[model samples]
Target: MRKWGPLVAVCLGTFMLLLDVTIVIVALPDIAGELGASLTGLQWVIDVYALVLAALLLGAGAAADVLGRRRVYAAGTALFTLASVGCGLAPGTGALVAMRGVQGLGAAAMFATTLSLLGAAYRGRDRSFALGMWGAVSGAAAALGPVLGGVLTQGLGWEWIFFMNVPVGAVAIWLTLNAVAPDGARGTRRLDLAGAAAFALFAGATTYAAVRAGEEGWTSGRTLAVFGVAAVALVLFGRAERRAVDPLLDLSLLRRGAFVTVLVAGLAYNAAAFGVMPYVSVWLQTVLGLSPVRAGLALLPLAAVSFVVAAAGGRLLHGAQARFVLGGGLLLIGGGTLGQAVLDADSGWASLSAGLAVSGVGVGLVSPALGGAALASVPARHSGMAGGAVNTFRQLGFALGIAVFGTVATSRMTDVLHDGGAARELAGGGAAALRGTVPDEVLRTAFASGLDGALTAAGVLGLVGGLAALAWVRSPGPEAETEAKAESERDRGDGVPAVGAGAPASPGGA
Candidate 1:
């Protein structure tokens, strides 16, 4: 009970953080209507959260080690709670976007410390089980986000979606304060400010360029300048990391084949699954004419199946080779996404449900396995950094996926409607413009065509991820497993119970 209490505290925060990702997706249409935001504005609302989180995660992890994991986690929880309040009370789109960025900063702190806290609390087989449980929570939270958001948006209001985080975050803070142990002392390692700055600049610049290209032309001067800035920042980041005594990100992790494979797999899963979810939600509402509640219910199959699959996948990671599981998962995702590409303006909910279920299963299989593989590939001491790295890649993939898919869909729709006056109105007025100006038949068909194109691209990316896993991911050797078990036995022999047994009580003894 004592050992598991901290896990619960961290998981609660994780669930809220991830839930915010998909929750806002279903609410975007409502937000756009109320705020009079353009399509580019919607993209920023989504992109900035991921962009900031991805940027700061590396630094957060390093800071946790140097300062204290519990301290960082507590501070993050407070910030997230306050920021959620700001989001709910935001006066306009700009205010909401800024608050979301603040929420991302808070989320980065909690996320980077989560796995490290678990590692500190548990060991050996118990650690594996804890991680699997963590994975399940992640999938379930994401799965529930849309439905919950939809229900809130339709029944209460869109603001309730952010408002709901307050109580949950409050509870999480209490649990964290009571359940987690305090750090023994601060480490002497210097914070890698240079590496952190360079990486953040590179990531933020690239994402900004992608979002700008989606609105302005790809070749626009502003976009080109941002791209150039991104390129130079990335080069500088690499140099800074190489020279740093304590790099924010250990570039050497890329040299390990397993780590690289896991990273790619993580990116692919997020790109195909989390990245495309918002657009799908929009399509359901605008093209299919489903209300927010109905649209959320429609996505239930994907979330439910993913939730179950992630739990099973985590347990499977104990005995099975991650390569097979990850490859198989990616294949499922590709097939599922490809199925969605077949959707047409006249298609019913049955087709969408089937495709979503398949993809959810794939996501389930990938989530836990990818996390486990990334942690296992790195040295034990580097687990916090490894966790941050994996999440950074996943979030970056999410940002890129949203930018690319949104651009494709919007551009294709514009091209189809180019001759119509409504096209110009859409460019300026956003989705609200289509409500009365464009004919229903024309709007549906054009948007459907754009959706198909986007799905096709996402499907191809999923296939590539699967193939990469198959080619590169491998099982740890039997000797390594034996040594790990022996280490566990030695710990037990030294009067330490396995985690979840009679392990040491947390500091405050919650």
Candidate 2:
């Protein structure tokens, strides 16, 4: 019971950190109006947070290993709390965006240290159970964010969405200080400044290109330039990784079949499920004429189904091999998302609810198991590194999901609403002004189709993921278990600190 408390504290922090990411999307309209933000500025509000977090995850994990996980974790929570306050008080878009970037840095710190702490606290079956619970909390937090955001935005204002984090962050900080144990102080390693900058540049340029392509045409010179920069940055990043003594991402990890397969499954699951969630809110409001609050209500069934299934699946995780659990879950997710492709303007509530439920169920089943499988393969000492790598890939998948699916949906929107010249320019003004002139049914039907098309692409991606999991994940057999046991025995003999000690510092302080 005592040990469980600390693990639960870290899990709570995980929930709050992740919840902040999705909670803002539904409130973007309100934020823009209140702050007088241009569309580009609003994009920065969303894009920069993710870009910074994704870029720094690896470095942050490495730092926690060297700098002391407890210190880093506490500092991150404090920073996030203070930054949230700054976000609420910011009078302009620029200040708000800057605060969000700071919040992302703090989140990166918190996220990078969590797995190591958990590994430090538990072992064997207890460790597995803790991880499963962590997955369940994350899933619940994700499902709850939009609904909570909608209610808050409508009732109070957009700023309250950020303000809401204050109490939660406070609790997380308090828990960490009392419950988590500090590791033996270790020396720092050399910071990989070049690798960090290169990765950020690559991700930022690519994301900018994707979002810009949605606003402008794909063929625009600006879009081409963005893509070119992304390509160059990626190439340079690869070169830096190869030459660095302590690479942020060890390319060799890709060769490990277990590691790579689970990572792929993680990426695939999020790509399909997350890509469509925000748009589901948009569809309910714009097409079905529901209010934001009502639109959020419509998603409750999906969340409920996912929550229930995820809890049950966590218990089953102890008895099952990850491949079967994850593969089956992906299959269901794919099936559910494919169902979206069949939706039309007149689709009944039962059908929509059923499809969403299926998706939720699939996600419930896979999210935990996939994450567990990935981290389980790495030595406990490498928990932070493994966690960072797993999460970075997942974030990349999420960003790509939104980018790619958003492109398809937006393109379809433009095609359906195509007017000769001047009329086409009118869509840029606002959907409200055009609402009166266009037939409501036609507009609804068009949006439904576009939404479905995006869902189809996501569904196909999930199916691809399922297939990859099946083909690539070699089932664990006696030989594998024997090898793992031998590895553990060898480590004990060599006097390496046990799995929960967290990683020791490299030769130099980074």
Candidate 3:
């Protein structure tokens, strides 16, 4: 108990953060119903959380290293808990979106420190065990969220999903304060708060552009204006980082082929793998008349397969080149998503089963390898920043993916129905509400076409990203050449066989 207590605390915090995200996926229709949220409102509900998380992750990690991991983790837990209360009590979409953005800030802080706290608490075999357990909890949290959310939403209310976080977070805080210890050392860099803000602006503006484009024409003045703002924010972010003494990210790393490849791979992997899921859930419940529980269950195969494959792949694929692994995995994801484009007007939930499972394999492969590849591609001094960068881009991908795909789904459906309002309603899973206004067969046909279009777009994105990663991913630095020379000299001196001669080195055999 003494040895494992800290792990429990970390697991609790991680579980809560991930669970909150997934539970909301299953509850979107319900939230839209109760709050009178439009399709755009629903998109923001998902996008804002990820946008904030991605924007603040780097700064949050730096704070944890400088301020003390235990303190930041505890404070983050408290903030997250309090924000969950606000979310639960929110009177409308505006209030709920605001609270959720706060929740993202807290999640970023808590998540940034979790592994560091564990590394400080354990060593050697215990470290591996702790990480494995952490992975298990994380996977279980994601797997359980939809089903548990369904039960709660069905039995209690959607608010219970947020309210449940109160007790869980309270316990996490108690454990953190009691069990976690101070770090052995601190990062010397100062915070890059300006960069964080600029990047946040960039992400927010980009999401707004995509969501707004769906309602107003893509070329509308408001959409174009926001896109211009996003581009400017991105430029300002780059400038700030280039000028900072200790930038949130060292912009110089972007010049490296390997590091940048890994970053894009991470982003594309997340977007293609998980972006369209909320819509899938909406379709199952709103169009097909599946209960929330059944809708949740429909998505379970992907999670289950990914978990199993990840567990087994960690050992089996260790020491392989990250380029091939990450690239191939992304290709598999693309292929799977492409396969799901088979959705026709007559298609059923079973039509998605094979594609989801295939994509799961890709998720399992890329999920672990992407981080390793990122860390391996950088100088030791920049490793922390690299980890934060990969994660930030990954979240950014999800945020953008949701908005872009929502636009695809909405636009295609609108083309079929020739009714923008009806398309938005259908996208939000309220198609049953429009039965009198639109024929059932017409609704199915338009939804099928829209979903198919979104899937094709995601698949093409993944394929393009995969091809780029494969082409550009080389060993990051001279580490491989240096290691080979040392091995050769050692063989002449002591005649020990070069055991890893052909592995072509990577992070944990990535």
Clashes of 2: 7
Worst 10 contiguous positions by lDDT, candidate 1: 501-510
Q: How does residue 484 of candidate 1 score in lDDT? A: 47
TM-score of 1: 0.91
TM-score of 2: 0.87
Q: How does each model score on TM-score? A: 0.91, 0.87, 0.91
Writing each residue's lDDT as its tens digit, candidate 2 over 5-106 gives 777678777877777766766666567657866545655666566666777777787676567777888888899889989989999999998998898888
Residue 160 in model 1: shift from native, Å? 1.0
Q: Candidate 1: how many backbone clashes?
A: 0
**Candidate-wise lDDT, in order:** 0.76, 0.68, 0.78
- Misplaced by over 4 Å in model 2 are 36-44, 92-94, 347-351, 375-384, 419-429, 475-510
Error of model 1, residue 50, in angstroms: 1.2
Model 3 CA deviation exceeding 4 Å by range: 139-144, 475-510
Model 1 clashing residue pairs (backbone): none
In model 3, how large is the Cα lDDT of residue 395?
A: 78
